[model samples]
Target: MADEINRAPAKVQSALLEAMQERQITIGDTTFKLEEPFLVMATQNPVEQEGTYPLPEAQLDRFLMHVLVDYPDADAEHSILRIVRHEQRAKQQSAPVAQSLVTQAQIFAARQEVLDLHMETVVENYIVELVMATRNPKAVDPELADWLEYGASPRGTIALDICARSHAYLQGKAFVTPDDVQAVAFDALRHRLVLSFEAEAAGVTTDDVIERLLSRVATV
Candidate 1:
């Protein structure tokens, strides 16, 4: 599954999914499954659509994270240029950073720590409220009601919870916060949303709808 590209040719993508379905190849091995969560990082040159295929909604929903990588910053670009200028010298230089920041044991420990994060009833309710609002925006605000075509499913709620826990763990926190939930809300819910024709015609995007849901749903 990690090798599967959502933006590959339709036939290629279909073959990949079919292979997974047939169990021709196990997605993540037992060690990976037990250690780190399975994640498929796929990239497509957005500007080049000649041989590229758009990802189907079902495939998109299978992904827990949909991060967008932007262009490098000025400092990064300068560093790249400097390295290129000193290519001969750089070839002889060893990397200053450590090869691995955290070991497998540490990663497993972090996963356990993430699971131990305190999730109060109120926080759980807040997570549910956010997911439910996606389905029926009218309950949250009448104005957003018309913009939504379809609501998120129960899987969305689960995704939100896992992402919030991951966010908390990244911050070295023992407890999840409303900020963690908010930070991961868009990535967890955006792809799961099905937009209406009207919304598309109006140029409204999934990010916009998710933002509206976030604003309408209360933390407490």
Candidate 2:
């Protein structure tokens, strides 16, 4: 992947994909059947162009989420500042916020509950329509048809469904909601958009594409 990214040329990318397919190179191990749903989480710095190969659209589509890490919030920043000040005041002082609230067992239980969240057929169709609209915006809202370069993949639908359940579990709900879908949409669909060169040149981003998709694709 790194080598192909450095090459950047379309031909190089095509050749690399072909080689992987021919060799059946598992980018990573699959614990289940080939048809089973799988999710891959990858990280890349959008600002860094040095030595890093930008992921191709096809490769990016394989990822289930593209989370962008931000800096600490105001409260966290204040706490960090207090720690630093205290450290400077007394060398013996240690940093604060050293407490573990949830155990590994608790997290495992939470995941189980998330899996048990009910997904009605209506909600399932809603998820599908939302993802489908990304590919063919004209079907949902004609105004968005010209803004998109390419739509998301089927993997996106799976990601949305799974993450929605996870969100509902966190919220102590036994059922998924439209809000749950919205909550996870950005992370699930951001990387799947294949923006046109014009969109890129215009400073449009994946987030913009996702927002448009959400507006055009309605819930049940």
Best by TM-score: 1
Clashing pairs in 1: 135-151
Count of clashes, each model: 1, 0
lDDT of 2 by residue, 23-87 (tens): 33244453223321222333455445665567677766655577777889999999999989877
The Cα local distance difference test for each model comes to 0.75, 0.74
The regions of model 1 sitting more than 4 angstroms off are: 1-6, 15-37, 82-101
Candidate 1 RMSD to the correct structure: 4.5
Over 4 Å off, model 2:
1-42, 81-108
Return the TM-score for each candidate structure: 0.77, 0.67
Cα-lDDT of candidate 2:
0.74
